[model samples]
Target: MSLSLIFELSIWITSVCGVLVALWLTWRAGKQRDLSALAGFAVMMALWCFGHLALFHGYQSLGMVLLLANPLMPTFFLHFALLFVNEGRACRPWLTAMTRHIPWIYITSIGVTLYSIWVNAGATIRLMDDRPFFVFTESGALNLGYTVLIGVLAHAVLLLGWRHHSGNKRRSILAMFGVGAWGLLLATSFVFPSFGIDVFPYPMLLLPSYLLLLVYGVVRYQILAVNRFANRALLALVMMLLVLCVIAVLGVFSGRVGLEALTNVPIWQLWLYSLVVLLMAALVYPTVRRITERLVFPGAVLNEQVLDTWSRQLNLADSWTQLVSDGEALLRRQLGQTVTIKLPNDTAPSGLHLCIEQGDIGWSAHVEKTDDLSPGMRLNLEVFGSLFASSCAALERSLALAEAERKRLDEQHLVELGSLSASMAHELRNPLNIISMAAYNAPEETRKHIKDQLARADRLVGDMLVYSGKLSLQYQRVPIKSLVSSVLTTLSTEQVSIDIQVEDTLQIDADSHRLQQVFINLIDNGLAYVRNLERGAMCVEAYLDSGRFVCRIHNNGPQLDDVLTQDELFRPFVSKRRGGNGLGLAIVKRIVDAHGGTIVHRSDCGWPVTFEVTLPPDNTEGDV
Candidate 1:
């Protein structure tokens, strides 16, 4: 009930909190050597605080027992500092040398404790200005020397480690340094009462601050990889205790303002104060957590703005593939971990995975890091996965409807073209045949010109039928070089210089006549564009690559119009060349499609225009 009693009880509570912190850190240690050393340090710290408490209560024998054990406190701290710097890396020379001295320090501590016992030396509780303080005898100086030696050595090691480390490790070292310095300063102040300095030793009552700093290191800098749930619970517990400790200290100090006021205050009033503190803590906890998240563990919790942006990007994706790729990239950037998104059919990459399914869509997302994801991150990922699945499902349905409409339109177009082709063949080819027969009876000089006109008209009719009609392939093993050379021999080569790069033994299984048409159309385009030059350049190449037959026709002529879309470039009626129906490439495209091949336009191969035709391996064969 007295002010002194209240202060003593506050110290007792703080000592107990230190023990609890020791247990918590020990539980978190796992198999990590650095963490084990840290747990050991915490244990010694708890014992040191307990030793002071025992001395204050006049338990001389028990206090001496604890005091004898206190010499190992600095040893544990030094070992912790050394192990921390060496974690996940080879030991540095300075740390290695420092580590070599640990056993000697341990030996010296034991010797000092024994000497202290032999001399009957330890601190005695004495009243200093009506407050209990520890006063040490001269023989206790050996203990002080031992403690100071180890404390200085540990701090020096921490300083070096801080300078040598970077990022989270550096920050962790700095936190430990601050805590160590405070502890050392407090330990030094304990010797002041022996010198009659009359210091109140208020630093001893602030022992809980050491535990708070360590918790901050674990939560903020990730000194220990505790999960988000545990972090929150531990933080809440520590904050509540801190608030109560602050309140209790205030209650004791208030007795100075009105000595008789709190002295006669009923015990129930104190209980009422504690209950109100608890209620206030509940109300303040959310705000405290927000501050802690923003300042202490920044970026660990994804904010609404980030989640909203991620969702928006995911919804904007046009296909399931795009959605998965973008989602993984976003998560990788946000979490600083390698992320993978696996569809139901995709093999999952190695790591911890979260499977999410929405509607008929399902995928698993994972990070390469083996550490379990924090609760906030895991929840964010799940939400992201759900949003991605829903968006992908909607996109899939939309695409399916669009594809169906596209196919229907294609079928209608094909029917119209078939009718048009039949009409053109019936209406135009008969007149071309009659013109050819009439040209034979004309005068020799005039008959030559008429024959040329008749031939040109006949070729135009044939191109239209090929463009609109389906191809029927007569498969044969066609030598690629022989086919290309035969097409080139049919065309006049005066205006263009041509290069052929096909191997004589290279062959493919295709319709020989239809395939020849493919080459003639492609080679004629190359010659038409290069006609302005006295000898423009062109090259024809054929080869097998990756189980597919490839032929590339390259020319130094002007490139295809950059403004044309892929579909427009292959349209039957589209032509940019003079005196030509645009049916040459269109017919080529039809024949290539019937043979299960792909054609691509290239501008990246140092050519003005190039068309690459790639046939499916099934429609292709090795050399004959």
Candidate 2:
């Protein structure tokens, strides 16, 4: 090939590559307003490259028509920059006004150039050193105007870059470099020729390189915010290119071996050859796709296995600490690196990190030797991180349910033991009372000690029976005020002040004896914990609330300890006060439950301690 033909071919190839890359970028960028502006910019660049290719091929009219799109390129770029900064919202009024007139400016410049061409006073094209170059035959006003317009747009884009750099320095620098390089090339193409320099449009050949830099910015910084569909489209494009390369290679070999026969071949044979090539591509596509996926995403298989194992382990994990430790160990094994897991209050190490959030709980993981991670490995890590978050949430819920079940079973076992002990105590009560009666004629001190021991044994048996549900209630309409008076009269010797707030007519359907026992246990328990017996006070308030008879028994006792607050207060053998069997509240709870009532302890009812009970009311009406 001649030097000029070789140069023309090189320019054509470069233009074709630039057009392909730009079109791909346009398709990948999708339909967001900012991305649409970017797509427009890419289209203009493709048209500009096509125009130069056409000019090299001696298609002057076609080249001029395509080159008409060139002036719009910088305008599209500026629009893209404005949208990028403002996130596709309306920009400053000045910027909006300036952008609105860019098309008019382009039209006016094109009009001047066309008018000059019509009058045969336009720029002339001449062959110098076997290369065609443009030279203005008259005043170079058109070239100067185009150069000035591009310079102004370039400065505007640079300013935008500077403004955006503060928040995203890497992406801003990359965008600026790409835009500046292209602007420099575009300026040199016209400015050098306008200044009487006879160089060809050598800068135009660098269009493909400029496109590569922009594409790098898009891929590295997600400039256009391309989605997964774009990634699949890019993969398809790569596959198509690979197929084309194969066909090209086959064509070259066939031409070398069958040059004479190929020249003599009929049109039908060419069609047949094309059909065979298409058939081969269709058959090879799936196999090629699988291989490419394996090569490009080598961690996919391992990621699937790791995720499956992670899910199973989380399901089986008995505790949060166990789950986190196992997850960290699994990740370390899969990635072949040290991993640090951080809980909510733990300090996070400096490294590449992923955050896992489960409700209000958050865990962060720092990856050691991050430089060893490939793109595929990083992708796997993201999938694993998301799974870890959801799994941790599931594990927490699972563990909570398990603990609740364990506590329920423990309570059931305690109830069974209480029943056995209560039965034994019942059997011993009669014999103990008989012994005390028999010793009635003995020495006074001995008889008195036996009587005290017998009374204590009887009280213990009563408490155990109530706690174990061994005692049944005989429900009757019991007046609230009278019942309270009776219980207080029995314990009147205790130096504690009692306040009653129930009406005389308020009554409830409960076993009067059991109801008295409930009050006696609660009042006596309160007195036991009171800090000052002389000043210690108790209040018994009753009212009808929400279709139930509500009673609140409050005392000025010490607040319950933290340990006692956590499910220990109403459990047998767990006491907060001295000289107590720990069964008073437990028996009280059982009796209330037997009467189909609810009782709960409250420390926030303007009292140091309070027990509120809600019971079914009797049919007889009573005043509040």
Of the candidates shown, which would achieve the greatest TM-score relative to the real structure? 1
Q: Write the per-residue lDDT of candidate 1 for residues 352-456, one digit (tens) a residue.
A: 554434443343333334356665566667666666666666777888998999999997898788789879889998887788787787899899988877777
lDDT of each: 0.74, 0.67
For all candidates, the clash counts are: 0, 0
lDDT of 1: 0.74
Across 506-526, the per-residue lDDT of candidate 2 in tens digits comes to: 877778888898899888887
Give candidate 2 misplaced runs (Cα > 4 Å). 1-316, 332-378, 385-415, 470-476, 509-511, 529-532, 546-548, 557-563, 593-598, 602-608, 615-624
Question: How much lDDT does candidate 2 score?
Answer: 0.67
Error of 1 at 217 (Å): 3.1
Q: Which ten residues in a row have the lowest lDDT in candidate 1?
A: 359-368
